[model samples]
Target chain A: MWLTSKIKQLLMVMKPGVVTLNYPHERPPVPANLRGQPVFDHQKCIGCGGCSDHCPARCILVRDVCQELRVMLYDGSRCTYCGRCADICPEQAITMSNSFEIACDQKEDITTRMELFMMTCQRCGRCYEMEKTNAIDRINLKGFRYDNLEQRALIRKTSETFDPTLLQQSDQYQRPSTKE
Target chain B: MSKRKELEAKLIARLRDDVVCVEKTDPRTIFIDVKRAGIREASKIITNAGARYLCSVGYDNIERDGTLGMIHTFALDDSDQFVCCRTSAPENDAIIESITPDLPSAGWSEREVTDLLGLRFAGHPKPKKLVLADDWPDGIYPLRKDVPHNLVPKGAEDVAYELDEAPPGTKIVPVGPFHPSLHEPEHFAVYVDGETIKGCDYRGFMTHRGIEKLCTTQISYNEVPFIAERICGICGSVHATAFSQAVESAAGLVIPRRAEFIRTMMLEFERIHSNLLWLGVAGHLIGFDTVFMQAWRVREQIMWLCERLTGNRKTYGMILVGGVRRDITPEIADDIRRVMKTIEDDLAIIHRAIEKDTSIHKRTKGVGTITKQQALDWSLVGPVARARGVDIDARRDHPYAAYDEMKFEVPVLDSCDVWATLVIRVIETFEAIKIVRQCLEKMPGGEFFVEMKDSIPAQRHAITVVEAPRGESVHYVITGEDNRPERWRVRAPTFPNLQAVPLMLLDEQFGDFPIIMGSIDPCFSCTDRVAVVDLQTGQASSISKAELDALSRQQQARHASLKG
Candidate 1:
């Protein structure tokens, strides 16, 4: 009777098809929209410091390292993952990734870094970043499909050091769709 | 005039000129400012006329009004109107008449104002230190404007939390400050004589995070919603939505219809996860492992679905001030329908298995009971009030969000026991599924957000309520200068329900303590910053047992004469 009772209890545990997962050997399926650690595209980042200012956790930091250098530091462990930073970003450079297996033994492994170069204002001589503002204006005036016409106007109007090839290739500088 | 207007008219007639002024913010709210001397009488008049006492909010308005401010909030369940009684006392001579002598449920709210704002309520029955830690020094109220938020004074060690005196032969058995049965740190001193519990006392608020002061002093208006979402882990969206709704009401802003539907959908989604979590916790407290495992296995899929909708499973930071951050697309609506169907199927199996079990019936039925009259006297809410045949739901009575358009019934059982509380939760889960489907089907198309360019003007007070899974969560927001609320008071449903636990523990088996306390689904962090500290410890006198019996007899004879 004791052996039969034990066997009966074991069968009942399997009613929900296996309760525990063999986590290391076989992974569970995560949804596509799961908010993991944030990923930053350095080419599109403007170093405007909006993400650092609006972050509730203060996980993102933008510090002026020198006359022409700005450093952005992010600590993933302190992040509440509320997505305020990504929403407030001027350029859509920061997006939440689907890689949620972010466990680490070392504290330094949780921190990420990005560096940017600054430009000077023509009138005030104050150091600033002009790449994103100019791009936004361009996206408003010229659509993304007009690469040939915009590049010729771009070289004539601005410095030759400014490159339009990467801007055209990425094809990311576009105004919001007319939905609202 | 409507019945609601008649109630207000009666109060104004009784107090006449003592009611300094009466203002109506909307058709649903009546704001009355009465003389400081007539507050107790006004409260008595309102309670006798069938208005449920909500909670009180206290703030420092010394600079603006030259006195401290206090507002007592009330709601009429039958007519769906909220009434506010505003009064203030001089800062130098800050004393007000107590209402706890008649309205027993207003005890904790009065005590909270006592310690936090330092306002003394005359004739308060058993006043003692609450909310602040035992080792905390006196004369330093955190909510006062003068005190800095980061001030951490050195605390005195070995300060004991004075418990009430043991009743005659019953010894005091302390249960927590942390226990396996209680998920948080709270102390319950149960006075038991052999196998029966004679009396009990509680000391909680160990989870106060000091976020209330931080939000008012440091954070801006846009960031306060994110902080409000962290008030309670299980009911995060409820707090966020309630705070945002209060702000929107104060500023007179209207959101799009689609945003309201999305907000309703998320609130119902939280109801599903929270109710399932409570079921698993209840089963674990009763020493049944199978029910706990099966309930959690069914809950895992809903967590993944929440992650799909809002990116994070638990916090789900989708709600903004006037609207939601993201819209629910057609594809996402279909996905939600599939996940909800699976939950409905799995829940039915667990419900059938537990409903017929003899052990569950024996353990829960006829245990931890409070009468219908006592439930009303204590002003209990949510499922705890519904189980006792008191039909009051914030969603149905005071309809906010898309609940006015959705059709669902408030499930009530008159059993008035732990068993009834469990059954009511199971029935409400199905109602949640039905409401979500209706919201998705009738969702309207419009702009997702209304960007307000005007700054929110100061000194507007709004009271908003949301029916969380456990009970009604009420937030009183008073807008202020510099874009933050001057005072934001949160009265979670656990605050009133937990206060009535001692009444339910009268003359019960000592083994039923955990289930009785868990019946309220207590969340200490939400009702943070104070406790009902019992101070009648054995130091009253070193009197003998025979002398105590004689003194008690004399007191009873005097009380009987007074009542007659």
Candidate 2:
């Protein structure tokens, strides 16, 4: 009984229900929600260094040089691919791409670079967040609108004003790139 | 009337003078600050009160208070209540009485405390290098604030781990710092009297990548869960979920109900894949590659399903501190059920074949038998305990995530052997499928994320347990300033189960070592996180067979000289 059943089981397994994927030549079916190469939307990136703070592996680097420009460098090698940067981005700048096959021989191949102009907080007079993204959503998230009305009004009032020469700060931050 | 209060009262009553302060952190957890002098007695009281010893966390709080802290966590599995006995020792003379003499399960933990935090355990049976590389210099404690996490001592001295000498009349058959059987770098000296295994001595922790030090020292609170996911490739979600829950609990952040349900679904999904993978590995261990191939074939479906559901095939980085990153839509729910059904069908055939097959039964049945008493004494969890009829599942006992809402069976078999463990895993896989189906059916709709607006103050400690595929995974988190954990200790299921392997391997045939180890579903990646020195030569690298033999001789001489 055991031998016959075992033979039957072996034959059943041989029915070709289970199959191996033909890869390299034939692409493996990647799901729509697959977290792959981190896509940086340069337009939406406010250079607040939020992604760096949210990154668990410290794969993201946001260095604000002399309060003029914010240099954001993402080393994909160091990234755990947790997609926290995409999830926690206040302006929804970072999102995951489906291109997960990020294998490369050279170090430069995996590195992602995005530079944005630094914007200073008018109230604190300290450089805070990346420039060019709407700051009202953040004000709401910090609960400043409900918690303190005066600070919210000040933030809103400051939003109307900007450094006239801020547009001429750097050509690097003005690059129209949203590479996924 | 409450079990938590009763346990606390029992602890305080037994050690009235010893209990300095009993702080009820939550309804289910109590932190009893007991005198360092009476720590052993306090621990014994908690254990005797039907609380299983979870793990001990040793933290170096020298910067703030000139003292080291040790927290012994115990779980009264029935009431899902956790009792943590906190004690402190002066940094200058950081010494605490070891509980290992009574609770043998805490042996490795105490040794680890001695290794990483440099806290001396007075009565630890084998107080040796449990975490660090053997060649690591004396007085270079990695976890201490003074010694930075990345500080590699210039020219680390070569001090090989001193392995236990082979018993008289038994020849030592050393198997791996690198062996076919062991997936990771680990040294095991199996003493055999002509194939009848006499005794076993293991010198492992070679894969200790210093994750605890890395995370606590560098990583922030939000990012820790991702690093926790990398702890074990197979059971990454277990660690991630446990660490996230621990952080959330510490901060008093109650996540959304839907988020909890999603977490439950993901964990069960992980269980399905991990169990199938283990079954395949077990098959491979016993020289049945056909079963291995078939099992893996069944498992790949779940892997694909997981990828489809949560982005990645393995490290489903879907979970965050407050909630899951992704949501389970109706379409995804149907997809999960379809995949689980297919896997269920595949596993059924394999299980029946193994059950009816005489060769499998002859090889596995009555081999590596662990009695219920032995299982309890060693504090084994997961299928290992269940196979021995211990009937302890952290899901049913502790009820973390949405497990309380989900209905599933915790299969307990009294056969108490490798065969029983094999059967338990098979049945548990089906149960996991059932759980995932129920989660998909009963999942509530709401926001998947909760933003933590309040600044989590420092020094709030929390303990969280996730019933991982292997067993129960425990994570202890103490919230610190600067948006990071002051101390995060993870006690993986393999950490305790691997300790009990020698007990399982005592007199069994040496040939059955692979299957026995495989049966435990040992995930060294989670248990160890740094480079460990070899037992013989005091180096981290694998040496030649001849060199290893010579080192074994040196170890033997060292033991002989000490004995003499």
Candidate 3:
């Protein structure tokens, strides 16, 4: 009986392969709705600094060119891969990416920064257009009657003057970039 | 509400007015701040009041104002109420008096504090670098607040610390920061003679990450959860959970019920896997190959369950500030339940075999005994303390998430030996099963995450502690006006339990050193960056238990060589 029992135990060990996962060769199923690093939607970003303010790691950087506050920048190097920035975005402008293979030799490879263009005003010098692509398209797109290449040129030229100090004094002077 | 309250009340009366800062933080644990001058007298008063020395000293640099805060904490008997004695020292030249004479466990914690914070503990019997490598510079204390947030030091700078071998009569054996036996990177300089271990110096490379400074200067609040979860590979869930809780608390946001249930489930799943991992490690340490194989096999079930549920093996990234990322469908829940049932059956076999196994008994029984007195003095936490019959489970004592509603028992073993710790862990695995089941059954229906529309409230500070697999994991957050936390402190369980290793290993046999030290399921040194120092005299001369055993074996081999 002892010999038979020993034989049975040994047989049991060999009868079936242990349920080992042959990973890399056979990929396991990744569940849907996996939260990874944040992916930026440059067009929808408002440069509101919400994601940067709400970001735990302070990885988000926002640079405003249109004064209408269109573009936001993010450095992925400092990002903790926390999905809070995506969850907190009011415009639903950010989503978490599954591409977490962020190992890089250079620090610059890890940083992620983005810029969004601002909406120019139709009648006034002020920029107020947001979420109205038609109005922005009619004003800035080349084919439209109200199209103004000058406004786009001015927006491009004076973007460097969108510094916090310059943004505060925009209405104080009639001109933005030019001394005249 | 029991003897603990009575003793605490009696002790509080005798303590000097300015000497103690008493406040009740958690239900079971008391947070008492003792002045620097009263460390000796206060410890005596505490001992007379039936309190034991839990651990010795470390510093929390409150701000970059360039003052390093030195803190020594003590614990009362049969209670989680710990007293912290603190004093301010110079950031540039951090020095403080050592309390190792009062409590032996302070010996290691002080060495760690000395290594990381550059605090010179005067009168410490064996003050040496316990965490940072030998080549680390003298003045670059990683934990100091004033450390320029961006400063990464020149590589391979030698530390100013000098290593002296334990007094000549003692035999010294050195273990590893990279030993195959230990699950994490920790080194021990053990001194032994004959069959007895005289003393030990617990060392590691912990302070390398510059994590705290990085959190303040580089990473924002939303990004901190993922960085914090990387603090420990095994207990990543709780690290993320606790960090999120701190941030949410600072923002004055209460996560929804469904989110809480999901968090609870993730935490319990983490607990199951962590405990099973330790089971396999402990089995391997005792040379029980069958047990190791079987335990790891069972652990694979938990890991698979985690992967199926969370989509990652070690770093499960499901946690958010207000809620978790993924939700378990009913089908997924049923599948998990089925897998857990299979694991539960296997654990029963492991428990029985561990209890009855002769080799395990010989290896673990009556070895590395930490008496209740010693445990209390050392202020140990998690299963290490529970094995010694101290009932302080942060989940139960301080209810967080779905833990308050879950029904489970806290395993306590008064034996305070390696065997008792294993038993406690095995029993707790069953309890963790109970917790997971309760969470699954009672999981409420609601939104998975709440969208935070409003800006974060300014200057609000909040702290949270979660029961990580090893022990209480704490996250303290001080939010900036920009809605991110200005300062975040994540204290893992091993931060306290690692202090108790010297006490556990003292007077034990050199042969039994590994298993005894392994008794405390230590995680890695905190998210600190690494600096290596090479001592001219002590490079490989520092002794290890295995080295001593090798010496004895060498003698035998020489005798055979001579005869042959």
- Estimated TM-score per prediction? 0.84, 0.87, 0.73
Q: Which number leads on TM-score?
A: 2
lDDT of 2 by residue, B319-368 (tens): 77878888888888888878988988878888777777887787799888
TM-score, chain B, predicted structure 1: 0.92
iRMS of candidate 1, Å:
18.5
Of models 2 and 3, which has the larger DockQ?
2
The DockQ-based CAPRI class assigned to model 1 is incorrect
lDDT, model 1, position B41: 83
Q: Where does candidate 1 clash, by residue pair?
A: B131-B529, B131-B530
Every candidate's CA RMSD: 13.8, 9.4, 11.6
Per-chain TM-score of candidate 3, chain B: 0.79
* Model 3, CA-based lDDT: 0.64
lDDT of 1 by residue, B1-564 (tens): 775567668877888877887788877787878888889888887777778998888888777766777788888888898888889998888888888888887888888888787888899986877677787777767788877665665565457679888899998888897688788778999999998999999888777777778777655566677888888889889988998898889988898988889999999999998888888888888887777887787788788888888888898888888788888988889999999999998888788767767777788898889999999999999999999988999999999999999999999899999999999998998999999999989999997766665678888989999999999988999888766788888888998898899998999888898888888898888888322222222447689755665666576677547433
Candidate 3 colliding pairs, count: 42
Q: lDDT per model, in order?
A: 0.78, 0.79, 0.64
Please give the ranking of all candidate structures by lDDT, highest first, separated by commas: 2, 1, 3
lDDT of 1 by residue, A39-130 (tens): 88899886665566456555675444344565667778678878787776667888988887888876468777887775533212111223
